[model samples]
Target: MKAMKRSTLATLINATLFSAVAGTSFSTLAEEAQAKSNQLEVIQITARKRVENAQEVPVSVSALQGDNLDAYSSAGMDIRFMNAKIPSLSVESSFGRTFPRFYVRGLGNTDFDLNASQPVSLVVDEVVQENPILKGFPVFDIARIEVLRGPQGTLFGRNTPAGLVKFDSVKPSQEFDGYAAVSYGSNSSIDFEGAAGTGLTDKISTRVSVLVQDKPDYIDVKAPGFEKEDSLGGYNEMAARVQFLYEGDDFTGLLNYHVRDLDGRPIAFRANLIEKGSNNINPLYDNDVVYHDAASRSTQEVDTQGLSLKLEWDLKEHTITSISGWESAEIYSRADVDGGYGNDFAPTMGPGFIPFSSETADAIPEHDQYTQELRLSSNFTGDFNYQVGLFLFEEDLTIESYSFDTGTYDEAAGNYGLQNGYAVQEQETSAWALFGSFDYSVSEQLDVTLGLRYSDDEKDFYAKRTDNPTPWNGSPDFLEGRANPSDSHVSWDLSATYKLTDDVNLFGRLANGFRAPSVQGRILFGDVVTVAESETTNSIEFGVKSDVLDGQGRVNATVFYFQMDDQQLTAVGGGSNFNRLINADKTTGYGFELDTEWVLTDELNATFNLSYNKTELEDDTLAVAVCAQCTVTDPTYTIQGPNGPEARAILDGNSLPHAPEWISNATLRYTKELEGGEFFVYTDLSYRSEIDFFLYESIEFKGEALFEAGVRAGYAWNSGDNDYEVSAFVRNLFDEQVVIGGVDFNNNTGMLNEERFVGAEFKVKFF
Candidate 1:
């Protein structure tokens, strides 16, 4: 792929800006300015456990209010709505409907293992979600979502080496209010969501919310005996939240409950590609092939439940607060490999060969987790604020895996038998931490913050296997191992912000952070059990935030450098077998992030976010290949693999997988209110620079650009005190077919990428 020309990049940026300006008028802008000035209000909260301006939190944070989400979703967008809209944030899920990986400033987990730990932590209403499955829960009825970039280990002391995302739902109010919306779209898609709340008394209130969304699969199943597309994907999500709040003269109490049940077809995995010029077949049709014989064709069900409580007391000079929460989830799934059975015998040998039929190599796993956190925060009378917290977490996971080779069974030779083996594995881990932070105002124009945290973690693993089934598979059938390693360490961060002017601020941060050691499943398959060492990172950043153009626009920009010691990474090797996790000797990353929002006119708004990242392995010795000369023994030495027989020769100095060097997005929105209702038009474009998907980086895959445009036209009516709206919208108007990810993992026989589809929708709202 060739590098993009400077002129082309500039053209795209300018076009985006022009489109936004084209949608508004001067008269409308004047009216909007006057209206906003009259309605402007201040938002105060405890971002640092004290009342302060949202902009003075001393952190890189972005917040989206519930009304903003309602407007975006009404325009046919979901939580993914914020992708590219925020700097230093990107989200991508696997080929299946599993948990999505979120990257912040080029730091994230890339391993596909089920038990892998993520560098970024997610907190919903002060409740920590430990299971990866629960991380994918849909976002709804939220008061606001805050994305805090950079390490937050001092306040959120779990696995926040990268950053933290917090979601605060709309709690119960002492007033009667509710919202309901229903939408129907193409592909048999239907979405119904509603939330209602009422005050039982002057001091008590309750709220309930629910969501149901369903859609047909995109692929067409064509097997001889199956009625539906065997490889298509779909999802069903149901969730609810209830909250209670009580306020007294000196004390405030709040409690809430949340539950979610998700059942969906994981992302469908295509095993092989249809040959070129093969009758122009539909790409959505499944071919009878399996990559690892471990693939499955089934839906997974994940159930999550949690509870949270908070209490606050107003003292004479300071406020006292206590927060506690617990969350747990269970997941079950059955995958089907080999969409169809085929003849196992050599085609040239004979006609009596029978195709093996089996559902082996499938997996069923379950996990449980519990967490507790206690924190106290207060503000001193003279320009000082402080917070201290303690956290504890534990999790247990179990998996039962089976493999069967259902071909011609030779009774005499156990090796050529019809069955292979059954395996059972279990893993358990626990973690605890204590943290504190303080912020002080050194002068009228300068502010500073300092924070520190200490943590300890432990893990244990047990596994057992049987080649044949028998009652004698007893207590000794399992091998147990424990990793009781503990680290008593401290992490600290310091930041100083200076108010250069009334509308501008300059800030710089120096932070030391660490990621806990991760258990490597690959070690369980080898002769020695080795634990990957913890990773430590030092980051230095400087940035400016300003409200410019007479308060009509806001821009935030930052440049940072990160040095990581013993970075954890997963390296791919022969035949889908690889290291789950290992500590790279050294890795360095540097990047710049810029985000701006401009209210160009009353009817028009524009937002753009861009990120530039460059990461490189700093050590040369660790990149050396293990089998540099064993051509016959190394299965990945084929002509299609990196360097052919010289495969191992090309294993050094490559960019990490999935870490693109450049990514950007721009959006333009225009809204016009008429006598009947309102009309909204939005257009967004995203671009990602070329990325190397493999460890060796010999195979080059070009990045893609995508454009999504939408329009919402509606009519609303006010009947008595109730309101109603009817609207129609379309998404992906251009219908661009962009590839999300490409892989050539198995013998170069298959290529897979996410497909594009256009959708039209109708929505009705009653309030």
Candidate 2:
């Protein structure tokens, strides 16, 4: 009888998975998961926007809901696939899947400037996706994905001093239902998603979501007179969302709209890609082959849109909230910044050394963002509770850059149209905030939290430089520079939460964060427009949030430290394709993080995360430039460059460019229910260690220690109103290709990672 019901459902799933991990306890999100009975459920988090129960949330959060966010984007991932998947998080980008670039703990801001200014910070649903092409929005119908870490600037404001990433989606509840999925991988890659929700009355409700991914042109390129189409890698992405909900009694409303599109392929970087001074990856690397030669044919395009509105009211014990948002984006990227082909005074060149033939372009054309938030809270549950807020922000940006002239090439044909160079940058930002949070219970096992914020920031910047292929250094330089930086800061956070038993909870936190005053202008190759002055961070944390074995495992650990004043730093591309903005008199970091969850039975469950950070940069009269050919370990000094001298490099303590002092990730899942439904396997792994792709230090730019893995297998059932699944997957499961980011002015270029994705998936649901 079907092999005796698969051996009696694997012996009743190993006796209910270790008797449900010795009698159950676990969970967190699918809307803050709260299951019971079948056990292992009851973990919720909002990291202080209240939804509590993450062992009482004293902040240092970590969350990624259900099926680990559907197996991390299910191949066809983006948002740098959330590099290192949380725990001192990290995500990088050279404009590949749009503009990722996020880092926490070790801070971040590697200036790929499209108005770059980051220290993490990206919130969705609660708005705040301040640029970076609207933070590459795409990650559909999510229900949770926290990762709060450090210095969240009181309730998230400004460019959070290295922290905050929150996304919450899936709302609209009279509950009708939804689901649809598709996946197909390996070079022809395809991924699709769908969602739906309903409720037409009884106070209205609605939801809709969609995503699509595509891949083609399958790599393999060589340009010689470029007829364009060696196909430099490929992608096509689309996104959509629409939501509405209205529930009234005391009142509530929510509306959201979203859109995105991308036609990719612009980060194939790989010229001598390391290995001359070794950072590996260059035995003539090939993942289908590449040689971005005579560039320009490699392109990227993006478009984005957003709109949001949230409202709530209930004045019996106090409750009111409002959020409004609008965002728009346009982006264009064209690469092949010297990853080989024509140079050495061109006629032709090799994949080996293409010393001069960077053809780049970056654009935003125009963009806008606006936000407003207002809040008031305290809805019963005494012992003093409070929350107050007001926030507003605006941004208008425009950035453009172009350069071409792959050096009069004719080595057979590829004649890159001479656009020489062009530049323009404009920024306008205004910000305001006033926030408050308070909670006190004093006894009953202690509880305290205080948060305050008062921010005011402004920026008006300008930079211009039209055409300059070195025509006597100045072709057009209308303005060259301008910045009107303004700042006002007051960030705070104080926390305490001791319940020490009853499933433990012990916490302590002290925080202050800021970042607002930064402007960099790459006037198509320098002309002064660099400013970095506002930076501040002060942090301290301690933690323990347990449930441990007795409750079927769950451990959250923390230990943190921070200090930053000035900080900010960007200084990219030493041989010069410029991006300079520096400020660092001090910068520091210390970390420890661990989040664990285990049910390990009753069909298995496991999650593990680890982090250890250490970021320095103590500035000893800070220096900049460096890398006129690898190997330069600190103390250098030269500076003259407009075409002369320029070696710089002092940066006192170092450590911060892409910071990676060990990070870890793990996941394991197993299930079996046989007869007519359930059978699963899941695997995931991530690791990071070495990193240092700029700001001094060398050995070919640095970036090595790495590991990645992914796997999935499945069978799920419930038919009638439907619910089905069938899967097979693998994503870079040991096809390891490493070498991430490096292009210190060309030769030895770099960038890789993402190849090896085999897939199969099908899902349907309507329950």
TM-score (all chains, Cα) for each model: 0.81, 0.35
Ten contiguous residues with the weakest lDDT in model 2: 22-31
Count of backbone clashes, every candidate in sequence? 8, 10
lDDT of 1 by residue, 1-767 (tens): 12334864564345334323322332234446543422112334445545466545566666665334554554223345555455677666542444666677767775555566777787888777765666766677777777777777677764677777777887888777877777776666777777888778888888888777776555555433333533455667777888888877888888988888877765444332222222122254332222222232455677778777888888856666777776766665544332333335423211112132233332335666777766777757788977787878888876665545534454754533244546565778888888888888999899999998888887777655544322232323234444544455578899988886666677888887777777654322222234678887788887766655545666666677777788776654333233445677777776677666777777787777777776667655554233211122212333343233423433334556566677786767677777755666666666666554445543223334444454455555556656776766655555544434423332212223333334444443334
Off by over 4 Å in 1: 1-52, 66-68, 71-82, 223-231, 273-297, 336-366, 402-421, 467-482, 522-530, 572-579, 623-652, 698-719, 742-767
lDDT of 1: 0.59
- Name the candidate that leads on TM-score: 1
Per-residue lDDT tens digits for candidate 2, residues 1-767, read 01323653454344334322422344222224443334357768777776887778888888888898888876578767778888889898877788899888888888887888897889988898978878888887798888797888878787887788988998978979999898888877788888999988989889999999988867766656553544777878899999989999998899999999888778788777687766777776777676666555568889999898999899989988898999999988887777777778867787766767778788887888999899898977778988889999988998898877765543444554457778888889999999998998999999898998999998988878867755655445454778899989899989998885577677889998899988888778777788899999898887777775555567777777788888888888887767788888888777577777787667888888877787788778998877656787777877676566777878887888888988899999999999888999999999989899887888877888789988898899998888889989898788888878888875767788777788898988895
- Minimum summed lDDT over a 10-residue window in model 1 is located at 348-357
RMSD of 1: 6.9
